[model samples]
Target: MESRRGQGSLEYLFMIAAALVIVLIVIRVLSGVSSNTPNQQVILYADPENFPTFNTSDNYFVYQTTVTKIGDDLYNVTFKAIAKRDLSHVKIRATLMCNKKPVYVGDQYLTVTDEVENLPKGWYISRYWSPIRRDEFPCEVVLYVWVG
Candidate 1:
């Protein structure tokens, strides 16, 4: 009879241990602690394509990229362009692309408008967009430039 009592006590302890293990798993899941969590950090980058071709095709390059947080999940991005040859009436516009898709803030796409009438060779020009919402990490800036 004593052995039967001991067996019952051991079974009770095992059940309690199992319950604690289940509770721990539940807590972990509720806290959103996991290895598969996606990274939400944003990184701004410059596109290397050099779109809207200029006379000195190989001379245009994006020399710098800057990103600053303006609000929750919102950022301001700036890209600086370096000119290798004389450029005049330079008009530049930029679009924000996240994961190869354009990022929209409200109902419009995020963009920037900046122009330099005379950019001499070896000069740098910067264009920026403020309060751009980013839904994904590692976004790129695409620039469309015109020179007259």
Candidate 2:
């Protein structure tokens, strides 16, 4: 009879150990799924061919503007430009408007590179990558130019 009691106790301990191992396996699998999943996924906003061009002035022209969603509140905006003449000093300003309301603004000084001059030629210009919120999508980007 004592041997039978010992056998039952050993069986109970074995069952408990097996249950613990199963619980650990489940926990590991769940952790791995969460780690592999991203909280925010990146997505393209608009097709390059469909992107709009904003030419506010004759001396400076704004080319295609492409927007990429990088996070829940982040975007990567790349736009092209062209100068009608050689500008010793130039300032390019970009404004993102949603529903006719301005949401974000950015600007950059044109660095004097051998590739860029005040000429009627296309040149890739500034990139604005920052958090601008997901609700502000489908925004219209307008670029203003100041050259001296």
Candidate 3:
């Protein structure tokens, strides 16, 4: 009789522990669901307002410039370069400006053709600048393109 009573009490405690675990799991799942709603979206990048959306030059055109935050103090700048004329080599120097002051400058050198000849007109290339450490937003980009 004493052994039977002890066994029943053990079973009761096991059931209560199981119930507590299930309740915790349900609460955690429900909390996760609420946190993932559309209103809680995260901003992956910074879109500067004063930056030029489309910029043109004699030898090339720069457009679709984007600044993305990669780390706490590092940011990346990317832009599309379209060749206005045929060229063998293209060099792009992009300067990130904040409040009329230069924050970071990056250079991208692209070989458009294998041979030492012109790549062709209207060819496009994407340039991703090295990461910079600038936390300010609403910045601008100054482009300098060289073709050979």
Candidate 4:
């Protein structure tokens, strides 16, 4: 007995296969898809604003504030910050953010001594404050570090 698919059925099957291939191709083209590997990131910081959005994506620390002082008519914010890379050649700078502006407190150079450079290879100034202003009393000082 000779068994063969009818012409109509064979044509229908071929048509269905062609339609499936065409649909796949159209989907691929429309999606504009190409294989991309995900990048690995280290979560050095975890905060709401630090969640990869406002970041410039350059592995830099986002400027943050910690309300170090909440006085009667002032708020002193001390921001704890460090350089991203080890042995970072940095110039220490202080800024007091009171009314949405940065006021520089002069630049301080790092003088690495035997006790500082040899034992701990880190540069940090714990308390960097601006000089007292004559026109201000009980003023708020938002301490921040500027990496250069």
Candidate 1: where is the Cα deviation over 4 Å? 1-57, 69-75, 99-109, 131-135
TM-score of 1: 0.44
In model 2, where do residues sit more than 4 Å from their true spots? Answer: 1-59, 72-74, 99-124
Q: What is candidate 1's lDDT per residue for 3-110, written digit by digit as tens?
A: 443457889999999999999999999766532332222223632233212212334543556767768877666677787788887766666666534344433546
Winning candidate number (TM-score): 1
Backbone clash count for every predicted candidate, in the order shown: 0, 2, 0, 0
- Model 4 clash pairs are none
Candidate 1 lDDT (Cα, whole model)?
0.60
Model 3 alpha-carbon drift over 4 Å, by segment: 1-47, 50-52, 62-64, 67-76, 99-118, 129-135
Residues 24-139, model 2: lDDT tens digits = 99999998776534332212232223442333334344355566666655565555555444554455555545532224433332112222334434544655444455554555
lDDT (C-alpha) at residue 58 in model 3? 47
Q: Candidates 3 and 4: which is better by TM-score?
A: 3
Best by lDDT: 1
The full ranking of all candidates by lDDT, starting with the best, is 1, 3, 2, 4
lDDT of 4 by residue, 1-148 (tens): 9999667988989999999999999998865542121122212221122221112122333333333223443333343333345533333233343322323333341111111221122333333333323223222323222222
* TM-score for all models, in order of appearance: 0.44, 0.38, 0.38, 0.29
Per-model lDDT: 0.60, 0.48, 0.51, 0.35
List, residue by residue over 12-43, the lDDT tens digit for candidate 3. 99999999999999999997775433221111
Error of 1 at 107 (Å): 4.9
TM-score of 4: 0.29
Scored by Cα lDDT, where does model 4 land?
0.35
Show the lowest summed lDDT stretch of 10 residues, model 3: 107-116
